[model samples]
Target chain A: MSQDTLFDKVWDLHKVSSLPGGSDQIFIGLHLIHEVTSPQAFGALKDKNLKVKFPERTVATVDHIVPTDNQSRPFKDNLAEQMIETLEKNCLEHKIRFFNIGSGNQGIVHVVAPELGLTQPGMSIACGDSHTSTHGAFGSIAFGIGTSQVRDVLATQTIAMNKLKVRQIWCDNKLSNGVYAKDLVLHIISKLGVKAGVGFAYEFSGPAIDELSMEERMTICNMSIEGGARCGYINPDEKTFSYIKNKLCAPKNEHWDKALTWWKSLKSNENSIYDDVIKLDASKVEPTVTWGITPGQSISINQQIPLLDDLAPNDKLVAKEAYEYMSFKPGQLIKDTPIDVCFIGSCTNGRISDLRVAAKVLKDKKVSKNVKAFVVPGSEKVATEAKQEGIDQIFKDSGFQWREPGCSMCLAMNSDKLIGNQVSASSSNRNFKGRQGSPSGRTLLMSPAMVAAAAINGKVSDVREFIN
Target chain B: MRSKFTPPIGKISNINGQCISLIGNDIDTDRIIPARFLKCVNFDSLGEYVFEDDRKTLKGKHPFDLEENKNSSILVVNSNFGCGSSREHAPQALIRWGIKAILGESFADIFYSNCIAIGIPCFTLPKNSIEEIQKYCHNQFLFLEIDLKKSLAKSKYLNFNLEIKESSRKMFLSGEWDATATLLANTSLVEKKFKELPYIQFCNDN
Candidate 1:
């Protein structure tokens, strides 16, 4: 028999039952929920008079609708207040845990789960949001489920799911100076095209991956959904074990040892055959930014958009659509597009490390008067770490608002929205039309340092200028 | 609560013989329906918002743009449809668009579940099968038969079995909401657990 791939081994271990429709009923080790999508599912539960089968297995938080500023009782927006109240009532009624605003644990769902150590290795995690792939950085199979499935998980610990084929993306070569994991993943996604990872779970492996800190790996996996992959993960290594060893949820002492052994077994066998294999060179990667509406419509800072006539027929239509929606000239250099706001937080790039990098660029420099810049750390822990290191002060001194931790304006579910068609140099993942709030608002996705650079210049200037 | 509930009660119909095909990879929720339209609580008017940017050009010619197709409700899209962004509004908007069913190569994980929950028959045919349907839809009315009785859907050129949770399928097919259906699945267990938790303990525990 052939050596089983990590995916095969994990699937075999977690398989609960085969449903009649040929989908497996995989057992989930953890389920994370939030205010936005859980209310309906809880309502369903209320109607059914069903209690959460395992309340301890589910964790909840409020990130979507919490105002980044002035999080007082009775939010100004009635809908936000209603959502918070509903979640509170539901969690209380079901006896599930919820981390509300100002709770030291409250933050972006993905950020809070890992920082508090609730997310663990070799455990399958699910949430009502797509970025649930963020947990896969710890060598877990995580999924973004729907509200109905939320009810399913709350009703029963296991969810019905079809097995996914594993695609091993092997990366070799050391990253050059100034090249970060964000750049590495962007290079990979651009190379693979947006749709390449559909129907597959991506297993990131390589010396470069092994060398990344756990936080960096989380950043890479955080945007896996952007590449059309349900989840992208790296097999847990010594770094993974070290990160989880002191986490609140990880096993203690001898149990830790047993857990580590099982986590180690989760890596693919040396000769494991993958449904697909994609190799990337780390040294060739560069800091990337999106020039068009889609994540895959990206290029290095120095490249220009392809002329409409040069693109393939289907691509041309998309390019034409992007050009019109973005209100950009056909061949304009992406480097020259002006930006109005600079956002440096989201599950995608909002971490202590991302803040530290942005602070490095903003040190002793002020944001251009023409641009409004701000930084929102991903979690309370991240905010505390940044403040401890004086990064918050650095951001404040540089004219950026150092706001409280939450999802912030990542998707503009709260008060942080663009006023009009003002373009934004953002660190968050998606650049879709009006994704940052206003119907006509535009977003240009880039790295934190790059956004900081744009904030300082009020345009799509290169970060290399301020690297020193 | 009954063991089997019916799917939602909208008039059900298969696709007409004629249709236009839009093929692309990784069509995200944002593209399906932009986030700006999500401010509304009700989904009844969102059909006009589907593919807003794409429909801007074909203002009059796009099938979705036409007044007659406003309730036409069957969406024919490409593989990996509804990828990115887990906004439930994506499906809600499609449902309000009068779309009774969707024929596609595959759907994103969350979108697929949302469609099933709301009684939208998400027909997943093989890539070649979708291609064949696209060809048949070009010249004739591509009529598909949606039979919730057997949990199978078919068209002249394609046939597919919808895969949904046993209970969820019943809710949709019977036009009943999931609240009552869920309560009945674990009625005994819920009542027993509620009985175990003392009502007065919550005020004293804190």
Candidate 2:
């Protein structure tokens, strides 16, 4: 047990009761719902004839099914239209606040919650979306749940959860200029393997992590689910407190100082015990990219795809499957593989900073004629900010479509999708087969700048070369 | 909107059914109920589309589509079963498709928990025992008797103890599988705890 880790402290604080079977009745402070996963949960509520126990604790947003290209009412996809409409009706009926399509606060649930300052330190947050861990950057214990769990949260404001073992993932040294948080997470996943964190909650700490911006820390926590951790979080600091202060849903007036004090104390103690601890040198990590279907199958831009003989016996099966599915040469340079589409958005890399970095790379540089590139802001607020900074124009000038915010092409629930065997360089999380639309489509996951680098060169190229 | 009917939550300590073995490692939730099927109007009728893509692509050769495997209630899987995306529909689809229980070498954390909440138990047997069970499934009409209370599974060719966690097994036995009721049972305590938080209390004051 990692005594006094941020995760442990948060988990202990939120624990309402211990059930007879080694599970805690954990109270959820914030419940985020999206159109894709919430309709069923709402339906479940109707079926069982139950009302939302703590409606105020829940927030609704439409992302996974909303169209990024069109903002017209009555969406083109009948299913998408029905789903959003259902969400609207559910929110209205339940009196839960919803950030709809045109709402300035509207965006991906993960992005919306934090930007609104609803995601705070020491809160136990649950969402029907896997990337819910994105909230963990503020020192919250956040994890993704299923619709049934969503239903559980809706009806009770709490979920019965088994306490998780804690693993302290220490990131040493500051990352070099060109490398981003997305690359750092990918590098961590590649070393840990996807299933390594199955029964544990990862507490990411140490000097390098402490140096990251809130959004950068968010990028790292966002993909903690990829490594199979139930949840992941970084302890709150001055940076965390400052990022959370004075926002729409954040504490105001007299409560501000009191809230700040509580958040400050939420950090782990000096000598905390951990079930396990893993260390990574951030300085050594490069702008990394996934070479296969799984997030764990990745290599640095300067490295080559691993040969079959180089893999462990158990790993060879998936590696062989990856080599076949990706159609890349076993020992080919990871930088040489060409890409057809370049998408730089999703909960993982859809924030303003991610857009700024990608825009910086795309500035004055045209996207390759062979590549289809686009930038989708994580939220409407991020989109507004990017437009203010003129980042969208830079993307447009570079031949990339500057689109509205929604989880576009991330899971491909909307019109944006890969056609046939078109491969993509995406800044979104998850490179699972058919993850970006077409059943045969392949996705290479990397940071926004790396995706921009690939878009300009029409191949998997090193972002370091593109950066000043 | 079509008002479909869903079966009441199941409560049984033992389930005996013919097994449908999906013998693969890291068999993800996407493959179980592909992302396309997740956009349902409701979760009630998702069972028909469970493994929709697999059934469509592998058609006659797919186990779920096989005449013999139809109505099979027990599913046997290899390591890391239900690994990706925390889609409750994966378990909802499985339960709806007539799967009452799942036995495997290992199970992903989310998938395992989701299974419990929906009244489906994800039991982990030893690796070799799981292998024996998978091998046994090849036989015609290979029915398995899984006793939840005893944590044992038996068939004509194999008999082994399953490693169902004490907490999870107790959940099934004590009828505490549905967490909603248990959580609702402690409403006052939850409210008391919520008010204690300075941040939340401040928001309410506004």
Candidate 3:
């Protein structure tokens, strides 16, 4: 009855053809590809005697399998080399632009797009990586696709998708100091549990969301996939406009005002109804950490591990499994757990601000001798900015190894990995078992500053303790 | 090993009972089984780790674990069930956990496909209906009527639509998710196609 929301407008505008299978062929506005997933997809295309339909719609970069440190040619790992070569060959064959290592542009796909101003509001962006929703921070409807879907996008510049209902997640009030977007999201996920956003698109709103920087908003929207939403986005605002203001793909000066006018018009109207609505208080959020294997199995840094008796009877079994796998004692303080390594990078929190925050903590302190600490930039652009600010020097001086940009140690697609059963304080998402590359590796999810503190203490030390 | 897909052999039991409500959001595959156990290509051993984080006693209290819900082929989950990464192992592990079907408000795209790729039937019910089902199940006995042949499920809790891809639905309804389709269709064509590849020829020459 009311005018359609931005989600509805974008979805209807992009609807190409509806198939009998109850799915719509939605035209993709922008397609992003990285090294690991694109290679196999391109190979599949080659096997099928196909070429990318619109190369211009697609952008390429090497991530997932690039080394953070010592990224020399013909990498020591054969599989890594093969993946890069295959991507190079595929991009060359298809005329797709590739941001390769040392290209001064190569970095995580999510990081490079924003820096280059490629990600704009009100666009449909798809990538072969799950964190593709990271682009949604700019008010775009972005999603991660599988290799087959990747091929589908490459072959047709479209994907078959079902429409998701809109869910407005309203966060009122300003966040206090020491609380970050990561903490806010962790709190939201914890409150919503793990399945609340099913069949829905979350429109993050309210004053707190409006005040966050574009990068901070990116961190919030990036993990929407973790909350089970098809995709999540914020309405395009002045902040969104300013973030994309004069870069590669953004509209020029005259067109900028026109774009803003149209973008502002796309916001959900007052009294607009949603299929679901979840409310949160911004000031209540604190630095959060995952005590169990799942993101939902998380607690505030000050809390102790939840004992089995504290959970529902049905949930106790899972609690026990987590306790066993994590080798953590029930009722023990999570902050005291020792860490063997500390990794700060991912599409999630690998931005320049994240580095600066960690650098601020590491300005005078040194990392523990037992901890293997490294800092990976999200993109080459972020790397350049970090260098310009001398943040890299600060990290190096604090014993944090400065490495090349890629999805290093996040999911362990690159040379960076944990050796064995080492527990790591990681800023990346998903602290699942062996997720950091080592078969027996352990990951403790936290903020970049928390990772820095852990690196210095070789334990799960709270960032607030060292903040002063 | 060029292993063929085998449809798991089990008795078909109608879970016409009231829904055992599972409430949560953004339930990821890692939480389902954790990434550590994914090293085993076969799902046999990893099935025990299903919901290992939430159902903590999976290792010690084997039969008491939620994995024990294995005997009950039907799973009733909350909204946004199976969100996060596009890992096929998520559904594979669920199937191995003896979940023949899942009823939820919604599922992650990749997770939904992974369920269909195997023989699992995932049906979506409206929220009101699911809530009603939960209420009914709590108060009295309720069971769902599932007719694989009719490709429809009926229950007091959920009467909403469950959309499945044409090819995938056909394969799942007929229990042909494994090599049945491949074997029933044609193998010689694939072999002949394989013969044309230089890589295959190189192997033969070697």
Candidate 4:
């Protein structure tokens, strides 16, 4: 059992009671609901004749199925319009606050919460989306829950769950230039196989973690689910405190001082024990990209795809499946591979900083005519910030489409989808087969800058070449 | 596709069904139900669309599509099954497709809980044992009688011990797997914790 770690502290703080089934009933400080998963949960609530217990604690947003191309009401897709309308009705009936499309707070739930200062240290956050772990970057105990559990949280502000074991992923050195947090996290997932985190909460620590900005930390924690961990966190520090200061929902004046004092004391003790410990040097990480279906089937930009013989016995099956599904040879180099679409968005890498980085790479250059490239900001605020900073103009000048927010093409819940077996260089988290809509479509997960590079070259090229 | 779907209810101590083996590792939720199918407001129509893409690719070769596996209710799969996405629709689709229980080498955390939440009891076996069962089912139908209390799955010629989290097993035995009621039982404690939290006192949002 992990002792005195930040995860332990936050978990113990929120634990309501031990249930008869040996699971702890943990209180959810923040419950985030989006259109896709929450409608059914709300329906269940209605069926059971229960109202949201702590309506103030739960937040609603429309994502997942929202069309990024059009922001107008009565969406082109009737099913999507119906889903969003259902959510609106539920939130109104339950008296819960909602961030509607034009609210400036509407975007991916993970991005909206942090920007609005709803995410904080020492809290327990739950959302219907797996990327809810993104809020854990603030030193909170956050994890994704299924719809049934979402109903439980809505009715009781608590859900039955087993405490996850904490694993300290200690990175020795900071990432090199051109190697962003996306590369570092992809490297971590590749190193720690996807299943390594099934029962663990990863605590990202040491010099490399501390060196990352709050947004970068969010990026790292956002992909924890891809690594099979429901929760991943960084201990609260000056960066976290400063980032939370003056935000919409942050505490004010004396309250802010009290919150800071409490946040400062939220880190793990010097001698805190972890269930498991793994150390790596982040400086060694390169701009990594996924070549296969699962995120773990990745390689550094310069490396060739691994042969089946090079894999562990346990990994051989999936590697074989990936090789066939992706239509790649065993020793084929991932670099210079053709890409038909270049997407830069999703909860993974759709923030303002991500847009700026991509825009910087795209400046004074034109996207390859063979590729269709676009950038979707994570939220409405992110879109506004990009426009004000001229980042959107830069992307448009480079022949990349500047689109509205909402999870566009990440899961392809809307019209933005990969046509047929077209390959895409995506900044989204998953590279699962058909994840980007078409049953045969392929996704190559990379950093936003890397996606820009691919867009410029019409193929997978090393981002460092551009940065250098 | 089949009859109207009836959800599992009450204490689930025994599950008797034929095994339908799905051979794969890290078979994700996206592959199970696909994102395009999630546009609806409910999971009622999700059953027919389960494994829609994979089934299309397999052209009736997928276990779920095979004539022999049509009525099988015990899904046997390999390690790290249901790896991505927290969508309960994956398990909901599977249960609606006639899966009553699952035996796998391991399951993803959120997917496992989702399975238990919707009353699908997921059990585990050793890698070798799961492979053997899958291999046996590939050639011929394997009927299994699973006793939750003993954590044992018995067939005509073979019997294997299953592994399940004690808490999950207890939840199944006691009908606490429908966790909303169980969680609501401690309403006072939930309210007390709310008041006791330090951030609740200091952080008042507008």
lDDT of 4: 0.93
lDDT of 2 by residue, A1-468 (tens): 679888888888888888887989888999999888888788878988999988989988989888898879988888888888889999999999999988898999989999998999988999987788899999999988988899999998888888999999999999998999998999998899888888899889989999999999999999998888879999899999888888888888777888887888888888988999999899999889999878989999988899998887667777877787789879888886899999999999999999999899998999999999988899999999998999999999999998888998988888899998899999999888678877778999999999999999999999889886
Per-model TM against the reference = 0.86, 0.97, 0.78, 0.99
Candidate scoring better on lDDT of 1 and 4? 4
iRMSD in angstroms, per model:
7.3, 1.8, 12.9, 0.9
Q: What lDDT tens digits, residue by residue, belong to model 4 across residues B1-206? A: 46899998999999999999999999999999999888888899989999999999999998889999888999999999998899999999999899999999999999999999999999999999999999999999999999999999999998999999999999999987899888888999999999999888876768
| Error at A206, model 1, angstroms | 0.5
The A-chain TM-scores of all the candidates are: 0.97, 0.99, 0.96, 0.99
Of candidates 3 and 1, the better by TM-score? 1
lDDT of 1 at A113: 91
Which residue pairs in candidate 2 have backbone atoms (N, alpha carbon, C) closer than 3 angstroms, thus clashing? Answer: none
- lDDT measured at residue A46 in model 4 versus the true structure, 0 to 100: 89
- TM-score, A chain, model 1: 0.97
Better of 1 and 2 by lDDT: 2
Q: What overall lDDT goes with each candidate model?
A: 0.75, 0.86, 0.72, 0.93
Residue A115, model 2: lDDT of: 96
Cα-based lDDT at residue A158, candidate 3: 70
Clashes of each: 18, 0, 24, 0
Residues B1-206, model 3: lDDT tens digits: 11233545333323343234455444566656554454331344545566664555335543215332334555666566676776555676665655667877677766775565456777777766556655654455445676655556677645545544554555554455432223313334333433432212211100
- True-vs-predicted CA distance for residue A189, candidate 4, Å: 0.7
